[model samples]
Target: MVIAAFENEKNLPLNELMIPLDEDGIERSVPALNEKWKDSRIFTRYTSFPFRANTTLVEEGAALEQWFSETGWFVKDMEWLLGLEHYRFWSTLVYNRGAIESVVSFTQSAVPYYLAGAARSSPSVFPLYSAAHRATLQVICRMITQRESDRCWIGKEFLGELLYKHYLVSIPLLFDLLPVYGRDNKQVLTLMVQTIFKLQPKYGQDLKVGLKFLQSTFKTIQQQIVTDRLDGNIASLTRLNDLAIYTLDCSTVLALLVECYPDCRSICTELAMEQSITNFYDNTIVVLYKNIHAMDNESTYLTYLNTARMELLSAFRGIVNFQLETVLDNPQRSLIPADKFLCTLTECLSDPVFVKDYQRHYPVEQDLDVLRQACRSVDTFKMDFVQNAYCLEDGANGLSNGYVEPLPEDDESFGEAAGGVAEDELAEAGPSTASGPVLTPEQQIEANVQKVLDVLPHLGDGYVRKILSRYDDVEQAIAAVLEGNLPPDLANADPTEPYIPADKLDTLFVETGIERLNIYDGDEFDVLVHDQIKGVMKKGKGMPGQPKNLKEMLDDKSHVREMKGRYQEYTNVCDEYDDEYDDSFDAMADSESKTVRLTAAMRNALVDELEDDDEDDAEVEEDVGQSGGKKTLDFCENPEVVRQRYEESRRSKFQARQGGFVPPGGGSGKDVVGKAKGQGQDKSVLLNRKQKGEHKSSRANHNRKQGATFKRNKGMIPS
Candidate 1:
């Protein structure tokens, strides 16, 4: 207190009297505690003197702006074990050089060292290299998604910083060649991809960037292969094998996309809009065919050739199935004369290796038989063409069907991520004979029951049936039963029936809609596509909310809205033109009266309030004079606070703090105004200061970051 009193620089914006001056005091003079000075933990604690990076400079400078993001009140003790409050923690990240950019620079620099031939061969270097690599990925993920919880994934507004500012978090950064992101760490790779997915709709100009990259990647292979492996020079074909690793990453991205948007038309709409995706499917299939016959059966470049082959085939099949199943408007949808699906396979027929592998792992014969059965009733296509497609029946053009070497058995799901009913579910529903009768919903319930049993066979049939009856979906019911998590349903009723449909009529009173009943053959096609689905997917624009961390919650932008309100008071001023150049008084200087005047209503209200308590003689005094030159308070923008003051003012003994009373029988003591305005130094300051900043909080508007004391934070923290 004595030191503060002696300080003559009290009026300065960033005066250091007692507490640490800005961040300069962070440079502790104590030799014994030098280590503590470097530690960021020192600042998070409450301190009398604290500061923040100047937001104006950050917003204006193009170079510095890219390295750092706009800091908010999110940094705190909980996120980092150190007990630093938001202001201290945020300043720590931005004050010294830059943390985010530094990490990026380090990662970029170390990539070459790790990729060097010596580092690659050295057993000792691998662990260090691997740890460093994973750490870099973790840092990238952390920076992009600051909030660790699920509820608020990557903040929507912060996404702007990621796209326009930080160049590290990009699609090419992860999905490019081995030199860029060498080791195939599935978890780390998935995290990077998820970051892109979350950033999408906004993140890199997003989905399109990733899509274009994948499109080019697939196109590259198709371009390299000149119709056949032999046509391309042997060297070029061998070079195609180099892309084996790259395609594996690309295939993962496509598989995730398929899983995210289960509907083929839906994803196609996102990638190419209403345009036919036949070419898109062909690009992938062409890449697969290239990989199948590329000079070598296996390459050191691609460790998981089998996995890649299966993925490529799976992604291609999904795309083809979508084009075939959807009631597309394109003329190519009519496969009556020529099957484009078989054409993609025709090139493969020449290669016996692919034929045997395809037959063994994922048989073409079975898939074709299923297609024939599905198209049996629909009149959309000529079943004869599909039936006559001999690509499945024959040795497939010169290739021999006799298996020379058997491929490994399929362990993973043998279908697209979002494929038809499971085997267990179908079995319980009972086999469908050629002349079998239609099954009731109860029979469908039986199918779901068996599906649950296949996974959790320990549970009794009755329990699975009850669960299936409660929740119509197989996955949902099984999940609920395993986790024992249930949400309250208002229309709860225990049904005696084994199965229940979600949209079906529970009682006769509820009328069944035609769409729901679907008396017409449910071909799962023919629905009108409102628009050619185009453009990258955006949030709340038909993009599915993917399952994220269990703890994730929706981001609350209320604070953002609140801060936005405060800045609106001076948005135009930042643009230029002298904001203080008010000319309202230019013409009124001579005509305007010097004396402040009140309206008739104000004078009348004042007189009435100043009247003596004698009810019989309630006549207000005439010529109610203005008291002690007290000015009327400016309007407060806060509706809630104004309402509160208005309520308090109407109290019988209402007494204001700022308004001085007029002499006897004049205006009432103190003002009865709904709200008081002032600079708001403190609660006591309210008695004297008028015209309070309506947007400022009670305690030093944002720690004076925007107050009269605002200054640059660079010099404050010691270098």
Candidate 2:
């Protein structure tokens, strides 16, 4: 029969004949068990028409047919299989590499395609439908693979296309097929829902169609509840988490739809207000809470609820919040008309009930005395742990290595000890001051550090071991002496000194414990500063320095939190601006000249910023002569100089602004049109540098044309 089907076809390849041809005269490469049958009268007669009214699918089918004719779909072909598999493989790699949200959507879309062959109508309809499903999957996989998270504008454009063409019609149609394959195919069905949701999040109206399908699902469940009650088939009649998921999905769909189509709120409001449905949702929440508290006994029954708890909570929370805002406070003016419903939802969220549920997980501490004791214990533990592992004498590294030095001891105590060292050391060394070319202060510090290292071995094994074990002591010592001058005799001492006077060192250490704080590690600080510079280069604020003044901290939280927040906000703003700029770029990419000009300008600006600290302040003044004249008057005041510079630049740009003029490629409508026109014409037709010489020679002729145009325009004036 396969041979017979192929024999009737004009295309010579039997493989090509097995695949259905789309209406566009191209071979459909997708696998089909009944290619001949789908084209025949039996299947199309019933399922064709109003059910398949989407023009986009029709056009896509034509395009698919043409593509398939070029490359046949061979299931056994390794290359072909790999090509299809590439989408998922790349998406997984990207997901693992920290591309979070988009990968979730991409992976979800593949689920339905995997189930297509299984979800068919008998043997007759399975082949053609499966083939079409596979084709759709291929396109989906390709689209997902190509989509980068950074391409937000491209996503918007694609979404507009999908909405306009109604490419979204396939989603709900595909979702409807899930149940037909049976409950055993639950994984596939779940995946399908997740994928559809992810891909179509922007298309809130399209999602409404899927939500409508789910609403019907609810009706079916309600019917089953009544039927089971009457027929003694009832197990537990309460709504499960799966029902909640469907409800949440519907709500999410409806929420977005409400933004696009506010009327959906009215329908949902009416349905939710109905006493029976409200009772059902309330009962569902109770069941959900019960399952959360006691899922061990009823594992199978609560499985769906347990798996979808987070989603259910989100939906309920949103619904409750929405109801509270729209209906609770302003009952008379409420558009939803479900005051009681809103009240119930609010009570469910607010009460001792919700609080109790959370408290089960995170119990609140009420006794202040006990809390104080507990906090002290925790602080003691932290101090002990850090001290043991990271004492200044132990030479511990910084936080990245899981160590923090103990706070410095008193400087007054250390000062007394240093005095003893100075006297004792001077008596032994015989006033070691230099007469010829004295050692520098830095040289003296290096000499002292070297002397410490040399004596470290001989300073008793325990002492040597403690100092060697911890780098924190060195950090503390450096911080302590950074401000104070060392003795001239010690500074004049040789770089390599013996281990004789360990007693004097204890004096120096005691005197130097003046609340030592490490400001920045030379290399580590640069890394932080570099990141801040990058933020500034991206036109975002640099991270704030530590808060010494109350005024700065009063801007927000504490010094630490405020600085961290500024860093985060800077990164976030850059991210947002990048998205906007990329969108602007993509919008202009098709217009070649504008993209080139805009890209060059952006690059030039970035380069200038990198090279010049005050590039932003370097806008040249229009009246340099006028500004130069003012320089005789006191220009020494920093504020006055800055203000004058700003004023000068404003004056310079003013004439251009007043003439209704804009710089070339300055993001204006006229500029875009001009650039687009310029890009469209061939470069050879445009005047080049070589042609410009001849054009300049003909300036008189050009002037004559301009003069004639001006004369003609002058004649057109009414005066």
Candidate 3:
């Protein structure tokens, strides 16, 4: 009947199918369907609806393919059948047994279809407009409840995919279904958490969707934890681990959102704080603290600080109770009372360094009270321990001397009287007992102040004494020392010397590696400065001011001498270069010498090449120019040969000119040589005079020529 109804309604439009069934149709169909299919063998025996048909029915396995093909629920263009009045009515009929199973099987099989359809469907229409969506939710709830069993309606992987699909389609429906399915069931919650974990990396890139899901899921788990339904066994452990993994995965996304969208950080921090507080154990709290502290934002820091202070306070209370019980129950063990231990703990908590971070976020007044109360209680208990110990010792000594008497068991008054006598004797003894004298609170405070003074050079003895006299509280004394507020001593032991701030003295005496001659005597400012200057002077000479022995000083002097020798060697190298330059000039000035004098051009070229290549060629060239002068002068000495070459060059130039050119001086080679010799001028003087006349002629005819040919053709003339 169900199959026939589905087949008949397969062609109906989704909108028409969505109309509610009338009372008559429900009355006529409800009973028939309930009687035929409610407890029928087909429904009772099979996990999924039997979609395949044959004249002789053969039992088919509950595969999802059978539902789509035979039922036509998910086939193309036939999905509207799920919205038919008869189909929804049929879903109502099987609401108890196979409804959830069939829905889960079908949704798991047709996840891609629903995901695609959800994209086009309106939010109001998805997961509820169709009987298939109702069935999908039923199936999800059943799967969550039945998650622990080996025989599941759908596999975990497929179930996870279906859940993610539903989340994409309608987040409202998914959230609604999560509590119904995962609320009380650890296995279901674990699966939900783990599925979210898997999908977060893939689809959770959407901050809104991802953060909402994470926060919702975390709240769900937290609710479970608060109601005490989550077992503390291994199964719950697995569930928590899954939750932790999901939180960690989402933390990175939340952090980015916190930075880019700072307003959202408060929401994220609150969510994290709630989750951490719900799972508030040692390891989880530690992880939360680390993550919160690592965030550079102010909100997270303040949240973490407040949370840590509360957690620490709670833990300390528990410790106090436990230790108190132990001390009360076992008085013979000589254990300190809880208050003493709490005093030590409070000392750590009240430290300015430790409390400096959280003071802005958490109130310190209560903590200061806790510290003071614990200390006062411990002081009272210390007197008790002392009195008890003294009484025990006296009794032991009396027994050893055979002078003690045991009180009768019925005489409670005798025990009270003996305790009173012990207390009185302790009071009369004035804190001095056989063991030792117990220091008063003031003395203890003074000792702690002295310890701070010993380490800090900025804390002078006069300042420390003044602080001690003003503030009886150890914390206040320490604070005064740190703040540098102690009154100055009016009477300087050395009246002749000027007053110096302790910080300046510290820098001058301590940091400068200056050691005092006698620390017992007060620090002498003049002596400290003199010693520091002497140490610096000695260091410059490589003589250690605080050498270990005489031999060390001698070795230092030798080292200094060796360093001076190396310095002298470095200076000699610079002098050698200067001397080379002077020697070159001296060689040039000698008239009879054959050394070559390099012009400024040659010298600059040599220097540039030396700088460019850093080669020995420049040095070799210098040596040859300076020392091998005879060879250079030998090359320059042959004037007749030079004159002959010049005449030949002049004749060649006359031939090459387009207009025939005459040789200058208009004479044979001997006439030129005789004229050059008759002038009694050196080669340099003759060359200069000839160059000057050529320059004049070139300048005079420059405009007539196509270009300045004389200047272009001028080669290296003799200097």
Best by TM-score: 1
Better of 2 and 3 by lDDT: 3
- Per-model C-alpha lDDT, please? 0.43, 0.38, 0.40
- Model 3 is weakest, by summed lDDT over 10 consecutive residues, at 395-404
lDDT of 3 by residue, 1-719 (tens): 22332233334321123323245335232322232333322221112232221111223455534543444443221233233344343334344344434443443332222123332233432332244434444434343331432221234454345445434323333333332232223354345434553543333344346556755654564454445433542234334434443343233223323333333333433334323322333323333333333332222232323333443333223333344444556655424554544443344432322222223233334433443444443454544433332222211110011111221122233435545335455556665432233458765555655554433323455555555667766577676556756556523322123224355545556667665555422334354344543222232434554567778756676678779977987765443356788888887888566778999999999898878675466666776888975324464568898899898878876666523545467532221232444558555446656765676565456454534554455743332
Model 2's alpha-carbon lDDT is 0.38
Task: Give the candidate order by descending TM-score.
Answer: 1, 2, 3
Model 1 stretches with alpha carbons more than 4 Å out: 1-123, 146-155, 159-165, 174-200, 203-205, 221-265, 268-308, 318-377, 380-384, 387-719
Tens digits of per-residue lDDT for model 1 on 38-118?
334332221111111111011224432322221111123223422332223223443432444444443434433112343
Order candidates by lDDT, high to low: 1, 3, 2
Name the candidate, 2 or 3, with the larger TM-score value: 2
Top lDDT hit: 1
Q: State, as a TM-score between 0 and 1, how close model 2 is to the true structure.
A: 0.23
- Better by TM-score, candidate 3 or 1: 1
Q: What digit string (tens of lDDT, one per residue) describes model 2 on residues 423-490?
A: 44444555442111235865544444543433221223233223323434555433333433434543
